[model samples]
Target: MALEYDLVIIGATAAARVAAIEAVNLQARVALILPHPANGQVHPQSDFYPYALAQIAKTIQTNRGQIQSPSSYPWKYAYTAIDRLEQESSPALLAAMGVDTIFGTGEFCRRPHLAFNINQRYLRARAYLIATGSVSDYPIIPGIQSAGYLTLDRLPSLVEREIPLRWAIIGAESIGVELAQTLAKLGCQVKLIVETEQILPYEDLDFANLIQAQLEADGVRVYLATIVTKVSQENRSKLVVMGDESIDVDEIFIALPDRPFIEPFNLAGVGIDHTDKGISIDNKLRTSHPQIYACGNVCGNVLGGYHSQSLTQYEAKIVVHNALNWRKIKVDYSSYDRLPWAVYTDPPLARVGMTIGAATNSPRRDLIILQKYLKTCPQAILNNITSGFCQIVVTRTGQILGAEIVGQNAPELIQILALAIQQKLKITDLTTFPCLSPSYTEFIYQAAQEWHTYNRNQKQQRQNGWLNCLCWWK
Candidate 1:
């Protein structure tokens, strides 16, 4: 018997779930296939969700907040507030729009379509969404396999494990930083090793330095400009070799970066071109085969370590729209120009838009960069939290080029800047906008005011230069 559907999404990730719901709204039959479990990328085991939700419930109870019943906070809520809404409402929502779910792995049966391999059976669909997402790539250091290390996918499972007193984590990527902090808070001594001179090499140096300070303050031993040559088990503990330095660790985590997860799908048969990054998709999210659409981490356009779940959802919406319309719609990736991302570690580093290095190197050398230390902020002083700084880059016209923040709630604060950048709001506009005083958000306005001052100084310099040139000519 042949199974069929109007649309078949080949992953049960955030993108896949969004695509499925959108297809259903278009009155298309949909089947979502997953090789393993359907839990979202971050919490595969579904354990973190319950723990997070419980914490939130406890916080609400302590505050005597009466928004919703405590029962409303479920394991899914632990993952995301949106996930809770989706779980409680998406099924009925999709069913009302005519979408169904199928659990399995999908393979390319032909071009522009796929055959799902589920429970030893093959199901087919007219159009397919290759939103399988990306997988983390662990380093192949000698004895690494024997010593045993956990990937991002395995971290949730380790939540139940008794984290030993001494832990060494290599790589200072978001996962590494987050895990290091989580473990440290749970009473584990964590030492983070990174090849880069600073943690979060992709972020602005000022922001990175702030995070480094925060990590150190948290009792995490951060080893900058370090390389891991080998991993070995000794004395019932993991021994990590970094040049001449050797460290004994009860648990060693290798937080090496990730690559695209397209190897198993065999895209060669479908005429989709892919590199180590991901499948080659055009701005329209169309693969080599026009009918086949791809999005999320499967598409190479996304910077692997720097993207957030919000950005992935935004991309998924574009892919779904173009797929349903069949009319070529160019995806505007300008959002990433000032894309906001946050490191979940304590004193989180959050940023949107270009860094100082990028701005200085770009063709637009006329741009100006301004920074404000958190120590100077009234709120930070009041809270006794002055570990980070805020930075803003703007053009001569006062248009905000980028913004970066590293401090408490930096992640939450970056969203406003991201919105401003997306809408092409001027720096002056931020200062005039109504915002609550004595809040971290006020930093945005303060930063913009600093930019204005810098802008005036630059203008004065340029005017003086012109007068000097004229005087010389006379």
Candidate 2:
């Protein structure tokens, strides 16, 4: 008798774990196949360490020139504290949930009627979900491979070494920006070479500009609109050559987006196609092959953010319900349509839902923009940290469409905006929400109130046509 399952999930990351748990609840026999973490199944703390370093950087900046309990090498904490893939995708937990967990990578077999081969064990299923996630992609510069580099997976080993005195970052994406600021705060001479004209091309220009300004103020040399043509090792230093500039540094970091993990499957052999971004999946999370579904980073451009774990968790819920049940449920990310993300810089950059750029370019011509500078906010003034602002995109009638926020506590404030957007609350509705006398949340209510007052006055002025307009007199 051949071993069979109702559903077989590939990869042992967030989506796989969630799918396994849900499958068991639905009384479906599910098996999760994963490579040993020591091999390649591990989802490294690449995304997480930047955040930890950011917190440490904030502490260092806050206590600078002041007496405080000092940890000489604060950057080491980025390595020491992280949750591993094994702990996250625990075999014992899966066993408790009655999910058979296999240790090894699996591939789609073409011969003998199409089965999946997990090392030597064969697995046949009624349906399948690929959730292998993505891996770090190193930059392609001349001599990059020979010169060597440090990725997130190697951060732990860096803790054992002496703190680097100088560092050079090749990209100014979210990771590059965070790492540059963190390293600079930790006393490293950091030079950031960028490939984009803007620090964060994917984000709203206002938020990206603020973060770039902060990075420069913190003593980071940011080189914009340049590319690294060559990288070489010379006399115990890494040599990075960009247009008209050559930087010699003790360490070089390449912060790029991760590529999907799709090698083992030999996808083309199975008529499954993919781009450099990731595996191609429809809005329903279904692949070209009818019975196969994909979620998480493996689904590619469908989820576009540095840390899309939240989206992955949501996608997993939909995948399990559809992959096993008779009626397929579509994966919908537009419920909130707000991707509230944080950059984890000292004063983090956070935004939820549609951004200013998105709203401005949207076909909706009646959208009104509302702004509140952090300097004017009571909490920002009281806290003595007033270097950012909050922006909201609203319809003429006050329908809340998007929000962008920057500075301390922006992450938390964005959460409120996320909920408001989810509920389809308007700017007028926000104005009615009670806020504490001296709190950060007051920024939202006050901004809405100010806009409402200004809009009302404009309406009244328009109604009093002859008195307000020179055209009437002419």
Candidate 3:
């Protein structure tokens, strides 16, 4: 029997949760499908674990520096907290909302009418949203299949049960660097293995190098510009190889974002467009098929080109509105640049909007770049926490395009930048805005004020060059 509903949201990601809740609010019957029995969002293995590990590392660093504890790593307490976070969602909550939560794989059917086959039951909805999120991507290293390794999603389970010791993370992207630094700070010997010369490659080149240096300073050995060709187990230890050189470790961690989880739907049979990257979506998040929509990291419209829970939550709202309402309101993702993202390191890395790469390809040709290092800031010196800088990109007209920070309270500072960019606030406005003296925020004001000095310097340099060229010609 085919159960009818107003909406059917595939997967149990945060995006799906939002659509389910909104459908319940509209008094529409909604079916929410899960890949497994466990809610992926609350699972101990997902995004929650790396975050838990980072906080534990911070606590360890704080206590050791303060002389409160001699041991730098403590997994016992952190695991306890992680276990608490894994508590499954109450069934009563879903029941109260009237959401039919089915734990099974769903395949869309093309025969007769548009419907999904979940287990043996058929569900036909007025509209469908594909919010299945992403699946993990591992490197193409030989002997990796037989050699057991841990992905970020499965990392919490490893930490919860095993003793903290030797760990070699195979990828220094956001998650890799974050977990590598975390494990190192928590008394584990960590080697961050990446093929790129710099960590956080998506960030500004300078910012990426700065964070890589910070990782090294925190006792993480970063092996850059070389891929792990092979991984094998030797004498109870995992050996990772890069050409002639090799290192042995207890575990290998995959700390990269996931590929879009859309292949199972067999979208091509129904004429929905997608590639290995993800499903293609317009500015309004509509799929090629008029009846289907895709959201979250499963779509090309992902603002940062990374998997983001906050982004999933935001896009979920837009998806639900357009899916159910008679008058489909176009999605306005203009403030997508304002979405603040932070990597949880000792001195965190956070950024928003265009990177140096983005500005180069942008329509705004006359761009101004302003940067200020925290080492020169009074607050950083007083606090003895000065491993950071603030960089901002803007147009000639002073419209803030992007900002990046690497420093204490960087995650918080980026928020101000996010709000400023969202409101289209100008550099002069930030510089004139009164802020507490001897604060990290002064970095923003200082960076903004540097633009005026940069203009004067540029003019002087041009004049001096012109004079020198005239002399040479004579």
Model number with the top lDDT: 2
Tens-place lDDT digits, model 3, residues 1-474: 889989888875667777788778888898888765222232312665667667766765433233222242355555566566444443346667799888777688878888888889888988889988876775578988788887755654554455536888887568888888877776678898887767776776877788878888888898888788889989888899988999988888876666777766778988888998889887667899877888987784455645667778888888888888877767677667879888777678888987766776677668877888888777888988657888888887888888888888898899888899988898778888788889877777777888888878989999999999999999
lDDT of 2 at 432: 82
List model 1 lDDT by residue over 1-474, tens digit each.
457777777775667777887777777778766655322253222323323533443334221222221233232344465356446435455555566665454567562345655665566766677887766675778988889877666644443444356788888666787767655544457799999988888776766776677678666789999989989999788899999999998777767766666765668876888888788888888888766788887675544256466667787777777876757678777666667777766666777788777886888767887888887777888899857778788887788888778776787888888899988888888889777768888777777789668868978999999999999999
What C-alpha lDDT do the candidate models reach, one value each?
0.70, 0.77, 0.76
TM-score of each: 0.83, 0.90, 0.85
Instruction: State the number of backbone clashes in model 1.
Output: 1
Lowest summed-lDDT stretch of 10 residues in model 3? 63-72
Where model 1 places Cα greater than 4 Å from the true spot, the runs are 37-97, 111-114, 120-122, 363-365, 455-474
Where's the lowest-lDDT run of ten residues in candidate 2?
62-71
The Cα error of candidate 2 at residue 372, in Å, is 0.5
- The alpha-carbon deviation from the true structure for residue 359 of candidate 1, after best TM-score superposition, in angstroms, is 2.0
What are the RMSD figures for all models against the true structure?
6.3, 3.3, 4.5
Q: State model 2's lDDT.
A: 0.77
